[model samples]
Structure formats: C-alpha cells, structure tokens
Target: MSIPTTAFLALALQSQAAAPAPAVAPGTIAVEVAEDASAFDRLFTDAVTRALSDARFVPLPLESHSRYIARVTVTRTESGAVTAKAKEPPAMAALGQVFVPLPSGKSQIRGLVSTDLSVDILLRGGDTPVWSGRASTVQVEGSAADAPAAVATKLASALMRQFPRRDPVSVP
Candidate 1:
C-alpha cells in the first residue's frame, strides 16, 4: 500500500532471487586396482566403479591423472567333508567265516564357504586426504555354484549404501 513498503517488498524479492545456490565440490573419484589382486578382486573393483557411477560421482582417470583413490579386496574360504565306508573283504576259504561290520545307513556331507570383501574409498587432493572410509561385507553361501557372484553383488550394494552422499564442506 505505502510506497516505502512496496519498495521494500520488491527489494526483498530481488534479493531472494539473486541468492547463489549451494556450492558443490568439483573433482573426481579415482579407482586403484591392486596389481596383485586376483581376477575376482578386479571384478569387485568394476562393480564398485559401476555403483559410484550410478551415484553420479565422476570416476577419474587412472592413477596417473587423479589424486583420489579407491581400493578393494576380496577373500574367500571354503570347507567341506566327505564320508566313505571301507569295502568288505572277500571271504577266505582257509580260515573260518570272516565277519565284517555292515555299512552304516547314516551318512552326511557338509560344507561351509565364506567370503570377505573390503572396499576403501579415499577422497584426496594432492597428497592430503579429504575423506576416507572403509566398508566390508561377509557372506556365507551353500554348495550352490553361483553363490560367489551373488555374494559380491550383495557386498557391493552394501558398500554403495555406506558411501557418503554429501561432500565435506571446506571451512573458511
């Protein structure tokens, strides 16, 4: 209504429109695969790369070009048991009747396999680390053949969930 009030309102609206959006950190996340890592380890690294890419984080070039690094490791253990009964010996003619213990009807086979996967994400600038954390997952699968991949996928999903969403703010 009043001229001074109308002017103030217009100024307020302009200020709100001109306010800058929040700052987003620039740079990329680098992935480093250990040279001694097995084929499965490399696969895990690729899975991690895919997860980070899906999350919109830039994957930097090889270690030569980028400072940030992500490392992954995979380990597996398996145990199993087998039961076999001794065969009965042939009857001997010279000696009296030879007796042998009858085969036991109860027999069992059991096995256990475990896998441990560790993922480390490091956000770095030059030689200094801005953010760093490690995530690991363990899975036990039965005698199924496709269990390894399933376990790795589950582990990768867990790692992705643990990844931090927001970059650390730089303090002035």
Candidate 2:
C-alpha cells in the first residue's frame, strides 16, 4: 500500500483497538419469568419480573421490537441441613427443621434452606447469550411464607449488581 494509505490504516486499527467495547443501552427488555412449577415455585415468574422492573429494566410486552430479552429461574428448597440425628421425640424440632446441624456430634444436620437463582440476557432472535449470572443464598425457614419475595429480591439485586449488562458487547 502507499505510505498515506498504510498510515491511515494503521491509525484506524489502533483506534479500533483502543476504543471501549459497546454496551447494551439502558432500554426495555422483554422479560419472561416462566411459571415453571416443576423447576421452581409458581410465584417466581412474578417475583423476578417485579424485581427486574424495580432494577429499572423496562419490562416491555413480548411483542416489542428487536430489543433485549431476560429470562430468569429462581428456586427455594428445604435444604434439610439442620435435622436432629436421633429421631426420638424430636427435641427442638422447630430449630432442627429450620437449621441443619453440623455433622460433628455437637450438631449433625444440614445447614439451612437454600435459594438459588439464575438469569440470562439475550439479544432478540439470537441463540447467543449476551450476559448471564447465578446467585445463591441460605436463610432460616421461618420466613418460608415470604421466601418467594425475599429470594426474588435478593437474586434480582445480585444479578443487577452490574445492572443493564453483566458483560459488554458490540451491537450489530
């Protein structure tokens, strides 16, 4: 190539390398928290949707444009960690059922109820994932009634720690 063309190409390549990667703009996302009872509870879809909205991810109807898409799955389980070793008469069964005791003689049980949540952000009509994250938490079973909302709040907050985008990508 001529000297001028070579220099111009070199500068262009340098700038391209130095430029920061593009990120998903703060815009609407067609979020779908499936009501998959077999995978989790029925309330998870609503909880996740609400949490994403609270995090400022505009929840657009599924019929919107070629924007972003967010799919999340949340689960809460009776980890059965803190059960009593001897099944004789269930001493402190309430606490035992809620908190799994340590396997050591001092306490031999599981630890606590565990909640796990995961999220996937994808570009519309694409098989590749733009961003994804997973978070888990353990809490006493006393709040079982509110566990749905509580876990949702925690998972959503954790996923949104980076918010909008967990990783950067160049838009087409």
Candidate 3:
C-alpha cells in the first residue's frame, strides 16, 4: 500500500526510542486480538495479527498459555488545518495583480487536514509500552489505499529490531 513517506521515518524513530526487549522466546507471547464486527474491521484485525505473528514473538491464543500479553492495533485520525507549500508565489502571484474573481470565482488549494496512522503495542497493560510507533502526513482523502496490514508490518519491524534480547532485563 502507498503510505506517506513520513511513516517510514517514524519506524526508524521508534526503534531508537523504545527500550531493549527482554529475553523472551519467539513462541512465548500472548496476543490480545481485536473482535472483528465488519469486513473492514476484519481486515485491520487480520493485518495486525498477521504482522504480529510475522514478528516471530509466538503469539498465543487468547485462552492459551503465555508468559506475557500483547495488544497490537492501528488507528487513523484527521486534524489540524492545511498549510501552503513553499516556493509557491503569493496568493495573488504578483503584487500588482488585481484579486479579481471570475464569474464562477477562482478556487485556490489551501492547507489540508493531516491523516495519521498510529500503531501501538502494549504488554501487560501498563502506562509504558513494549512497542509503539506512528506514521502521519497530509494524505489526500481519496488518494490513499486502505492498507492497515502494511502499516502494521512497518510498526512490527521497528519494534522487533532488538528481538530475542541478549539481556534479561526489559528496558523501560
């Protein structure tokens, strides 16, 4: 899926900021799966679950036995006003240009709201997170594809950079 370039940058930033992982095996994790009530929801859930599994933490079923619990999910939200790009001339283009309107009036593109995708991973339900990351940019409303899975993959990779930790202590 085509995501904003900034999303990849977020992946890098998160990798550096997160504490190192603990000495956990690939199959010792218990994943808290989200309920799928609709096709879209199912897609998102499946993507998240699949990505988590790909990270090789060995996610256990909700009722299965595991040492720790993890919750993975992605959310999209829009906010803030759009701004003009640099290097563009003024709204009038020229200082002496009369800002006259046509019979139908002229329309100029202004700032657009930002669309951000937040990917989070929680272990044992606490204020601190086992993994977390987000990717955001001024995505055109209809120009982007609905690919929660791709976003999850990026988030997972970033979080798993230090997988199978060499240290026994979990970084805070």
Candidate 4:
C-alpha cells in the first residue's frame, strides 16, 4: 500500500478502537427488586422503574414477562472504611466541624450509612448475567443522603447510567 493510504488506514483503525461499545437494543425489560419486606424494597423498585424509563427501557410490571430481567440487590454494611469524605447537612453548619482536614490535605466527613447497590441484567433462562453494574458509597450523616428515598434514587441513577451496554470491545 502507498504511504498515504497506509496512514489513512491506521487513523481509521485508531478511531474505531476509541469508539464506545454499542448499547443493547432498546426493548422491554422486567425489573424486579429483591423483597425484604421493608419500605426500602418499594422505594428501590420505584427508583429503578423511573431510571429504566429514563434510559428508554420499557420496564415491565413484576407480574409480566420480558426477555430481559433487571435484578436489583442491596447490601448494607454494618460499618465501612471512612477513607472518603462526605458533605455535612445544613443543620451541622453551626457546629463548624463538618470537615476534618487530614495530613494528606484531604478533608474527611462523617458518614451514617454505607451500602452497595447493584443491577444485573440477564437473558431469560440464562444462568449468567449479560450486563452488570454496581454503586457503593457511604452516605453523609444528617444530610439528605441519609434518607432512604434519596439513597435509592442516587444509587439507581448511578447504576443505570451505563445500562444495556456490553463491555468495551478491546482492539487487538
């Protein structure tokens, strides 16, 4: 090949390598949140439903059937590492102790709850998940972050942001 033609082919290949993976075809998806008989189940279900809708996914009722199933699971830890800092609530403004500066020049804030939220999409009758994503963080204490509704909304939104997309295609 001529030098110019070879360079053109190399540039085209590089651009293709940098492109993101194609998202799963838009279609109906059944959303189901593992029930623990608590208010959180309902809140998470509603949050997931809203997020799916926002992502252009047709979330089906639990009783209905669909080819894709989005399963949500929540795991709350009794305590987690306090490595990351969180923002304090308005009520704590008067305390003037919201953030503690560390020797490393990082500020640390108190957290009331730490949880892990995950969503796994699977094909019907499939044993392995086709796509999965997880969100984990310690919510700021005394702030809106501690509210269950807020937590559900935040986690669901974060998790679904990358939904329906297969892992990136690595160029050899």
Candidate 5:
C-alpha cells in the first residue's frame, strides 16, 4: 500500500467495474381509454400493459407517449337484490284473541350499477407525474368481467410502488 496508495486503489477498482447500470427510464408509455368506456377497458389496458412490461417500464404506444401524461380513472359499483314480494296476505287485526290475517312479507329490490374508466397516460418528458391514480371497486355480484382485471392489478401495484429506485454508485 505505498506506490501512490497502490495506484489509487487500482484506479478505484477500475471505475467501479466500468459503471453504467442505473437506467430504468426506458421511455414511451401512453394509454387512453374512455370512449364510452366498457369491456373492462380492454381488461384495464391489458393489466396495465402487463404490469408495466413486468416492471421494465416501456409501453409507449398511444401515439408515442402523447406528452408526458399519466392519468387513470376507474370507477365501478354494482349492487343487486331481487325478490319483489313472494307472499302477501295480511291486513287485519287481532284482539281478545280472535282475528287472523297477517302474512305479507318478503320483498327486496335493490339496484345500482355504475362504470367509468378514463385513463390517459402519455409521458415522454415534461409535466412529470408519470402516474396518476383513481381506482374504485364495489360489486355485489354483478358485472364480474374480471372487474377490470382486478382494477388493473391494483393500478399496476400502485404504479410499481411509486417507482424510484436507482441510486447506488460511489467509488472514488
């Protein structure tokens, strides 16, 4: 450990083994679907383009990331209940013990359906938000078309857990 600190520690370990390995910003990622949304918005854009291409992030096809945009809106709520009366015959009284007439109960009817999906994701630089959000799910057994691929796999696992992992290189 003398010759100029061993040649500066072998040139800082050969520049940390010839750097270059922190590039998770592939490019392109646009998706817009809201034209009278339905059909599970193409299965939630094919499960968020296969979970952002399996986390490799690179799905810009909507005219080439329109313009650094990321918007996803999906609202769903379905309810059901049918039994509008199944027996009716009760409208009298009964006192001093005598006066029958009571049998009219059994009716249930509930309904409420809603579906809205508006997603527009296009990012190629500028106005950086890379991942907007808006997901809701509530179905009481109605329209079970994979429920938009389970809400696009929970919004692509919450935008891949807020993507931001690429910083570990310091050897000088």
Candidate 6:
C-alpha cells in the first residue's frame, strides 16, 4: 500500500560559543568526519561542506591541513512501537486538556526515527571546540536511497543557517 505521508521537519537547533571568543572570520575550513563514516554520514558531510561554502567559508579537502577544522557527527536513533499522544486543539486549551494529565495512547506507531547532527569548529591543535551547534529532527525512516539525500540536505541547510554568528545561548 502506498501511503502519502508528510515528512516531519520540526528541527530544534542549539548552539554555543566557547567562552569569550573572537568572531570567526571567513577563511578556509576543513571538514572532517569519523574515519569509518557510513554512507549517511558521508552524504551529510558533503551537504554541510556546501552549506559552509555558501556562507562564504572556503571548505578545504579533508586531507588538507587548515587552521580551522569543522568536525561533524551524525546519529539516528530509532525505536520500535512508538506511542505518541495527541495534543488538544488550540480552541480546547481552555477546557483543561492542556493542563490535565491525559490517558495513555492505545495506538502504536512504528518506523519513526530521530536524526541528530552536531558540528564543532576548532583550531588545529585546540582540545576544546571554539564553536558548536546541534540540530535534531524526527521523521519516518525512508529507504537507504531517499533518506540520506533528502534528510541530510535539508538538515545541513537548516543547521548551517546560524553558523559562526548566532551568539551562544545557555542550554539547560
């Protein structure tokens, strides 16, 4: 059965600066991924490199030594038999559904996964990250071919929207 379903694209972004730091001036940045990166990770890195380039930062080849390095990691967490509770409509908020504890949901939804992306920018020899950001989203898991490209591209673009600029906000 072909089900026409929309991909959930609610992305949450959190970024922080390492102490009082200097603004990142446009310069060459080397993108690095885990040595044994999976297909999804490779695709995500490529997309992020493009995003960095679009932001006026030159992305150097992975092997090339550069003053700045953009180390990124991507992870997907999946769970079987998910239970999602329905939220009351805005008009029903005054009826106390929003405040009162709702009963357990009876239906079990499957195949949903949470994808997380984290990027850390650091100096060549620095042990601590000079800047960092994380983005996360949940969507139905697609086949190998479609998921990596679609999800990686969209996630990379969204995460890079605040590169090097958004002042660090304390995340609890």
- Ten contiguous residues with the weakest lDDT in model 1: 163-172
**Candidate 6 lDDT, 78-169, residue by residue in tens:** 84445544344323223544554445444445476777778788887787887787777676555352377877777677777777754432
Best by TM-score: 6
User: Roughly what TM-score does model 6 have, to 2 decimal places?
Assistant: 0.64
- Give the higher-lDDT candidate: 4 or 5: 4
| Number of the candidate with higher lDDT, 2 or 5 | 2
- Select the stronger candidate by TM-score from 1 and 5: 1
- The candidate with the higher lDDT, 3 or 5, is 5
Looking at candidate 6, the ten consecutive residues that score lowest on lDDT are: 6-15
Q: What RMSD value applies to candidate 6?
A: 20.2
| Candidate 5 runs further than 4 Å off | 5-11, 18-20, 29-45, 50-58, 61-148, 155-157, 166-172
lDDT of 3 by residue, 1-172 (tens): 3577688888989988895654345455565656655554445445545655766666667787665565544445654444334333345433476574324343344434343333444444455555554444444233322244444344344445444332221111
| TM-score between model 5 and native | 0.28
Per-residue error (Å), model 5, residue 68: 15
Backbone clashes in model 4, listed as residue pairs: none
lDDT of 1 by residue, 1-172 (tens): 9999999999999999998643324347777777787777777788777766665667876655554666666666664444433234544344356555444555445444555555555555444334333344333235333365565666666656555543221111
Residues 1-172, candidate 5: write the lDDT tens digits.
6999999999999999998544346354665556786776667766766665665656666666343444555555554554344435667688778997776666556444444443434345555443443434333333343345665676555554445442221111
Q: Estimate each model's TM-score.
A: 0.50, 0.56, 0.44, 0.61, 0.28, 0.64
Better of 3 and 6 by TM-score: 6
Q: Which stretches of candidate 4 lie over 4 Å from their true place?
A: 1-23, 34-36, 80-111, 165-172
lDDT of each: 0.57, 0.63, 0.48, 0.69, 0.53, 0.70
lDDT, model 4, position 69: 84
For candidate 5, list the clashing residue pairs, or say none: 28-60, 29-60, 68-123, 69-122
